[model samples]
Target: MDERDRAIIRELQANARLTNRQLAARVDLAPSSSSVRTRALEERGIITGYHAQVDLDRVGRGVQALIAFQVRPLSRDVIRSFEAFALQQREVLSVFVIGGGDDFLVHVAVPAVADMHALLMDRFSKRKEVVGFRTSLVYDHTHRWTVEPVIED
Candidate 1:
Protein backbone atom coordinates (compact mmCIF):
# COMPACT_ATOMS: atom_id res chain seq x y z
CA MET A 1 0.00 0.00 0.00
CA ASP A 2 1.00 3.62 -0.62
CA GLU A 3 1.35 6.45 1.92
CA ARG A 4 -2.30 7.52 1.33
CA ASP A 5 -3.51 3.96 2.00
CA ARG A 6 -1.40 3.79 5.17
CA ALA A 7 -2.79 7.14 6.32
CA ILE A 8 -6.37 6.00 5.69
CA ILE A 9 -5.75 2.78 7.70
CA ARG A 10 -4.16 4.69 10.59
CA GLU A 11 -7.07 7.17 10.76
CA LEU A 12 -9.68 4.42 10.59
CA GLN A 13 -7.94 2.36 13.28
CA ALA A 14 -8.13 5.36 15.62
CA ASN A 15 -11.85 5.91 14.92
CA ALA A 16 -13.84 3.49 12.82
CA ARG A 17 -16.92 5.75 13.02
CA LEU A 18 -15.28 8.53 10.99
CA THR A 19 -17.25 9.64 7.96
CA ASN A 20 -15.71 9.39 4.50
CA ARG A 21 -15.40 13.21 4.36
CA GLN A 22 -13.65 13.34 7.74
CA LEU A 23 -11.36 10.45 6.82
CA ALA A 24 -10.52 12.14 3.51
CA ALA A 25 -9.72 15.38 5.34
CA ARG A 26 -7.40 13.57 7.76
CA VAL A 27 -5.70 11.61 4.96
CA ASP A 28 -5.62 14.60 2.50
CA LEU A 29 -7.66 12.84 -0.20
CA ALA A 30 -10.93 13.67 -1.96
CA PRO A 31 -14.07 12.29 -0.26
CA SER A 32 -15.00 10.20 -3.31
CA SER A 33 -11.46 8.87 -3.56
CA SER A 34 -11.44 8.05 0.16
CA SER A 35 -14.71 6.14 -0.13
CA VAL A 36 -13.38 4.16 -3.07
CA ARG A 37 -10.12 3.43 -1.28
CA THR A 38 -11.94 2.31 1.87
CA ARG A 39 -14.13 0.01 -0.20
CA ALA A 40 -11.10 -1.37 -1.98
CA LEU A 41 -9.38 -2.01 1.39
CA GLU A 42 -12.46 -3.92 2.57
CA GLU A 43 -12.65 -5.94 -0.64
CA ARG A 44 -8.95 -6.81 -0.34
CA GLY A 45 -9.59 -8.06 3.25
CA ILE A 46 -7.16 -5.50 4.75
CA ILE A 47 -10.02 -3.74 6.56
CA THR A 48 -12.06 -6.15 8.61
CA GLY A 49 -15.25 -5.61 10.66
CA TYR A 50 -15.59 -2.81 13.23
CA HIS A 51 -16.33 -3.27 16.93
CA ALA A 52 -17.21 -1.27 20.06
CA GLN A 53 -15.04 -1.34 23.19
CA VAL A 54 -17.04 -2.33 26.26
CA ASP A 55 -16.01 -1.65 29.85
CA LEU A 56 -15.84 -4.97 31.72
CA ASP A 57 -16.20 -3.35 35.15
CA ARG A 58 -19.39 -1.57 34.13
CA VAL A 59 -20.88 -4.93 33.25
CA GLY A 60 -21.99 -7.49 35.87
CA ARG A 61 -18.86 -9.50 35.19
CA GLY A 62 -16.35 -7.30 37.00
CA VAL A 63 -14.06 -10.02 38.41
CA GLN A 64 -11.56 -11.26 35.84
CA ALA A 65 -9.07 -14.14 36.14
CA LEU A 66 -6.56 -16.01 34.03
CA ILE A 67 -6.67 -19.78 34.55
CA ALA A 68 -3.71 -21.71 33.20
CA PHE A 69 -4.11 -25.43 32.55
CA GLN A 70 -1.81 -28.40 31.96
CA VAL A 71 -3.66 -31.11 30.15
CA ARG A 72 -2.73 -34.82 30.12
CA PRO A 73 -1.83 -36.94 27.07
CA LEU A 74 -1.15 -33.69 25.11
CA SER A 75 -2.89 -34.93 21.99
CA ARG A 76 -4.86 -33.01 19.38
CA ASP A 77 -8.19 -34.59 20.36
CA VAL A 78 -7.78 -33.77 24.03
CA ILE A 79 -6.78 -30.19 23.21
CA ARG A 80 -9.72 -29.72 20.85
CA SER A 81 -12.15 -31.13 23.40
CA PHE A 82 -10.83 -28.81 26.11
CA GLU A 83 -11.07 -25.82 23.77
CA ALA A 84 -14.63 -26.68 22.76
CA PHE A 85 -15.68 -27.06 26.38
CA ALA A 86 -14.10 -23.73 27.36
CA LEU A 87 -15.75 -21.91 24.45
CA GLN A 88 -19.20 -23.26 25.41
CA GLN A 89 -18.88 -21.80 28.92
CA ARG A 90 -20.68 -18.46 29.46
CA GLU A 91 -18.09 -16.89 31.79
CA VAL A 92 -15.13 -17.63 29.50
CA LEU A 93 -14.01 -14.48 27.63
CA SER A 94 -11.04 -15.91 25.72
CA VAL A 95 -8.88 -19.03 25.46
CA PHE A 96 -5.32 -19.41 24.25
CA VAL A 97 -3.50 -22.67 23.55
CA ILE A 98 0.15 -21.94 24.01
CA GLY A 99 3.50 -23.73 23.70
CA GLY A 100 4.91 -23.57 27.23
CA GLY A 101 4.65 -25.23 30.60
CA ASP A 102 0.92 -24.52 30.50
CA ASP A 103 -1.05 -25.98 27.61
CA PHE A 104 -3.92 -23.50 27.81
CA LEU A 105 -4.65 -20.08 29.25
CA VAL A 106 -8.31 -19.31 29.81
CA HIS A 107 -9.61 -15.80 30.52
CA VAL A 108 -12.88 -15.53 32.46
CA ALA A 109 -15.04 -12.84 34.02
CA VAL A 110 -17.67 -13.33 36.68
CA PRO A 111 -19.63 -11.44 39.32
CA ALA A 112 -18.06 -13.06 42.40
CA VAL A 113 -15.22 -15.24 43.65
CA ALA A 114 -17.71 -18.04 44.36
CA ASP A 115 -18.61 -18.06 40.64
CA MET A 116 -14.96 -18.39 39.72
CA HIS A 117 -14.41 -21.23 42.18
CA ALA A 118 -17.42 -23.11 40.90
CA LEU A 119 -16.27 -22.65 37.32
CA LEU A 120 -12.87 -24.01 38.24
CA MET A 121 -13.89 -27.00 40.39
CA ASP A 122 -17.14 -27.94 38.65
CA ARG A 123 -16.09 -27.23 35.07
CA PHE A 124 -12.34 -27.44 34.42
CA SER A 125 -11.10 -29.49 37.39
CA LYS A 126 -13.73 -32.14 36.72
CA ARG A 127 -12.52 -32.63 33.15
CA LYS A 128 -10.48 -35.84 32.74
CA GLU A 129 -8.07 -34.22 30.30
CA VAL A 130 -7.13 -31.40 32.71
CA VAL A 131 -4.19 -32.67 34.81
CA GLY A 132 -3.48 -29.48 36.75
CA PHE A 133 -4.36 -25.78 36.74
CA ARG A 134 -3.65 -22.42 38.37
CA THR A 135 -5.87 -19.36 38.76
CA SER A 136 -4.69 -15.76 39.05
CA LEU A 137 -7.07 -12.85 39.67
CA VAL A 138 -6.61 -9.78 37.49
CA TYR A 139 -6.39 -6.51 39.42
CA ASP A 140 -6.26 -4.32 36.34
CA HIS A 141 -6.44 -4.63 32.56
CA THR A 142 -5.43 -2.27 29.77
CA HIS A 143 -5.10 -2.67 26.02
CA ARG A 144 -4.48 -0.66 22.87
CA TRP A 145 -7.44 -0.60 20.49
CA THR A 146 -5.60 0.89 17.53
CA VAL A 147 -2.43 -0.73 16.15
CA GLU A 148 -0.46 0.20 13.03
CA PRO A 149 1.93 -2.17 11.29
CA VAL A 150 5.54 -0.93 11.32
CA ILE A 151 6.70 0.30 7.93
CA GLU A 152 10.20 -0.70 6.85
CA ASP A 153 12.58 2.03 5.69
Candidate 2:
Protein backbone atom coordinates (compact mmCIF):
# COMPACT_ATOMS: atom_id res chain seq x y z
CA MET A 1 0.00 0.00 0.00
CA ASP A 2 3.01 2.27 0.40
CA GLU A 3 5.59 3.42 -2.14
CA ARG A 4 7.84 0.49 -1.34
CA ASP A 5 4.96 -1.92 -1.85
CA ARG A 6 4.24 -0.30 -5.19
CA ALA A 7 7.88 -0.63 -6.21
CA ILE A 8 7.88 -4.30 -5.24
CA ILE A 9 4.81 -4.92 -7.38
CA ARG A 10 6.42 -3.16 -10.33
CA GLU A 11 9.57 -5.25 -10.15
CA LEU A 12 7.59 -8.45 -9.70
CA GLN A 13 5.30 -7.52 -12.56
CA ALA A 14 8.36 -7.34 -14.79
CA ASN A 15 9.62 -10.74 -13.65
CA ALA A 16 7.89 -12.88 -11.05
CA ARG A 17 10.83 -15.22 -10.59
CA LEU A 18 13.17 -12.54 -9.16
CA THR A 19 14.81 -13.61 -5.92
CA ASN A 20 13.88 -11.93 -2.67
CA ARG A 21 17.38 -10.50 -2.36
CA GLN A 22 17.18 -8.96 -5.82
CA LEU A 23 13.73 -7.55 -5.25
CA ALA A 24 14.76 -6.14 -1.89
CA ALA A 25 17.84 -4.52 -3.41
CA ARG A 26 15.89 -2.96 -6.26
CA VAL A 27 13.12 -1.79 -3.96
CA ASP A 28 15.73 -0.49 -1.42
CA LEU A 29 14.42 -2.59 1.45
CA ALA A 30 15.84 -5.32 3.61
CA PRO A 31 15.24 -8.86 2.44
CA SER A 32 13.13 -9.74 5.50
CA SER A 33 10.98 -6.63 5.14
CA SER A 34 10.46 -7.26 1.43
CA SER A 35 9.49 -10.84 2.17
CA VAL A 36 6.94 -9.76 4.76
CA ARG A 37 5.44 -7.11 2.49
CA THR A 38 5.25 -9.48 -0.46
CA ARG A 39 3.58 -12.10 1.72
CA ALA A 40 1.06 -9.56 2.94
CA LEU A 41 0.25 -8.52 -0.62
CA GLU A 42 -0.32 -12.15 -1.59
CA GLU A 43 -2.50 -12.80 1.47
CA ARG A 44 -4.57 -9.68 0.84
CA GLY A 45 -5.20 -10.85 -2.78
CA ILE A 46 -3.37 -7.88 -4.28
CA ILE A 47 -0.84 -10.22 -5.82
CA THR A 48 -2.90 -12.97 -7.35
CA GLY A 49 -0.60 -15.47 -9.06
CA TYR A 50 2.08 -15.84 -11.71
CA HIS A 51 1.45 -17.00 -15.26
CA ALA A 52 3.50 -17.95 -18.31
CA GLN A 53 2.70 -16.81 -21.84
CA VAL A 54 2.17 -19.68 -24.22
CA ASP A 55 3.40 -19.62 -27.81
CA LEU A 56 0.75 -20.64 -30.32
CA ASP A 57 3.24 -21.14 -33.17
CA ARG A 58 5.33 -23.53 -31.10
CA VAL A 59 2.31 -25.69 -30.44
CA GLY A 60 1.62 -26.15 -34.14
CA ARG A 61 -1.32 -23.74 -34.00
CA GLY A 62 -0.54 -20.46 -35.76
CA VAL A 63 -4.00 -18.96 -35.87
CA GLN A 64 -5.42 -16.88 -33.04
CA ALA A 65 -9.03 -15.72 -33.26
CA LEU A 66 -11.55 -14.01 -31.06
CA ILE A 67 -15.06 -15.32 -31.53
CA ALA A 68 -17.97 -13.27 -30.26
CA PHE A 69 -20.99 -15.37 -29.36
CA GLN A 70 -24.60 -14.23 -29.29
CA VAL A 71 -26.86 -16.56 -27.40
CA ARG A 72 -30.62 -17.09 -27.66
CA PRO A 73 -32.73 -16.97 -24.48
CA LEU A 74 -29.81 -15.27 -22.77
CA SER A 75 -30.40 -16.80 -19.36
CA ARG A 76 -27.71 -17.64 -16.83
CA ASP A 77 -27.94 -21.34 -17.64
CA VAL A 78 -27.63 -20.73 -21.36
CA ILE A 79 -24.65 -18.44 -20.86
CA ARG A 80 -22.96 -20.90 -18.54
CA SER A 81 -23.62 -23.77 -20.93
CA PHE A 82 -22.03 -21.93 -23.86
CA GLU A 83 -19.05 -20.90 -21.76
CA ALA A 84 -18.52 -24.42 -20.47
CA PHE A 85 -18.79 -25.96 -23.92
CA ALA A 86 -16.34 -23.45 -25.35
CA LEU A 87 -13.82 -24.05 -22.61
CA GLN A 88 -14.01 -27.82 -23.07
CA GLN A 89 -12.98 -27.59 -26.73
CA ARG A 90 -9.34 -28.35 -27.54
CA GLU A 91 -8.83 -25.23 -29.63
CA VAL A 92 -10.17 -22.78 -27.05
CA LEU A 93 -7.61 -21.20 -24.75
CA SER A 94 -10.01 -19.11 -22.68
CA VAL A 95 -13.69 -18.20 -22.58
CA PHE A 96 -14.90 -14.92 -21.18
CA VAL A 97 -18.50 -14.07 -20.38
CA ILE A 98 -19.00 -10.53 -21.52
CA GLY A 99 -21.62 -7.84 -21.41
CA GLY A 100 -22.55 -5.21 -23.99
CA GLY A 101 -24.11 -6.82 -27.03
CA ASP A 102 -22.82 -10.37 -26.78
CA ASP A 103 -23.05 -13.18 -24.25
CA PHE A 104 -19.54 -14.56 -24.51
CA LEU A 105 -16.13 -13.82 -26.05
CA VAL A 106 -13.99 -16.83 -26.70
CA HIS A 107 -10.23 -16.96 -27.51
CA VAL A 108 -9.27 -19.80 -29.75
CA ALA A 109 -6.13 -21.00 -31.57
CA VAL A 110 -6.11 -23.43 -34.45
CA PRO A 111 -3.87 -24.97 -37.09
CA ALA A 112 -5.56 -23.14 -39.95
CA VAL A 113 -8.56 -21.10 -41.04
CA ALA A 114 -10.29 -24.18 -42.42
CA ASP A 115 -10.01 -25.91 -39.05
CA MET A 116 -11.52 -22.87 -37.36
CA HIS A 117 -14.40 -22.88 -39.81
CA ALA A 118 -15.04 -26.54 -39.19
CA LEU A 119 -15.12 -25.95 -35.44
CA LEU A 120 -17.55 -23.08 -35.87
CA MET A 121 -20.03 -25.06 -37.94
CA ASP A 122 -19.62 -28.50 -36.37
CA ARG A 123 -19.18 -27.61 -32.73
CA PHE A 124 -20.86 -24.28 -31.92
CA SER A 125 -23.52 -24.14 -34.64
CA LYS A 126 -25.10 -27.36 -33.39
CA ARG A 127 -25.76 -25.86 -29.95
CA LYS A 128 -29.36 -24.75 -29.54
CA GLU A 129 -28.38 -21.69 -27.49
CA VAL A 130 -26.03 -20.19 -30.06
CA VAL A 131 -27.93 -17.57 -32.02
CA GLY A 132 -24.98 -16.06 -33.88
CA PHE A 133 -21.22 -15.57 -33.82
CA ARG A 134 -18.54 -13.48 -35.53
CA THR A 135 -14.87 -14.33 -35.77
CA SER A 136 -11.92 -11.91 -35.96
CA LEU A 137 -8.54 -13.25 -36.89
CA VAL A 138 -5.70 -11.91 -34.76
CA TYR A 139 -2.58 -10.97 -36.73
CA ASP A 140 -0.66 -10.46 -33.50
CA HIS A 141 -1.37 -10.28 -29.83
CA THR A 142 0.93 -8.69 -27.30
CA HIS A 143 0.48 -7.84 -23.64
CA ARG A 144 2.69 -5.60 -21.54
CA TRP A 145 0.85 -4.51 -18.42
CA THR A 146 1.74 -2.36 -15.47
CA VAL A 147 0.53 -1.45 -11.96
CA GLU A 148 1.82 2.05 -11.46
CA PRO A 149 1.22 3.87 -8.17
CA VAL A 150 0.99 7.61 -7.73
CA ILE A 151 3.79 9.04 -5.62
CA GLU A 152 3.21 12.14 -3.54
CA ASP A 153 5.95 14.57 -2.68
| Candidate 1: residue 144 lDDT (0-100) | 39
lDDT of each: 0.91, 0.89
lDDT of 1 at 54: 70
Clashing pairs in 1: none
How does each model score on TM-score?
A: 0.82, 0.81
Model 1 scores worst on lDDT over the 10 consecutive residues at 144-153
User: What is the Cα-based TM-score of model 2?
Assistant: 0.81
Tell how far residue 145 is off in model 2, in angstroms.
5.1
Q: Judged by TM-score, which candidate is best? A: 1
Residue 125's lDDT within candidate 2 is 92
Query: What is the per-residue lDDT of model 2 for residues 20-123, given as tens digits with 9 covering 90 to 100?
Result: 99999999999999999999999999898887766779988989899999998988888878888988999998899998998888989999999999999999
Most lDDT-accurate candidate: 1
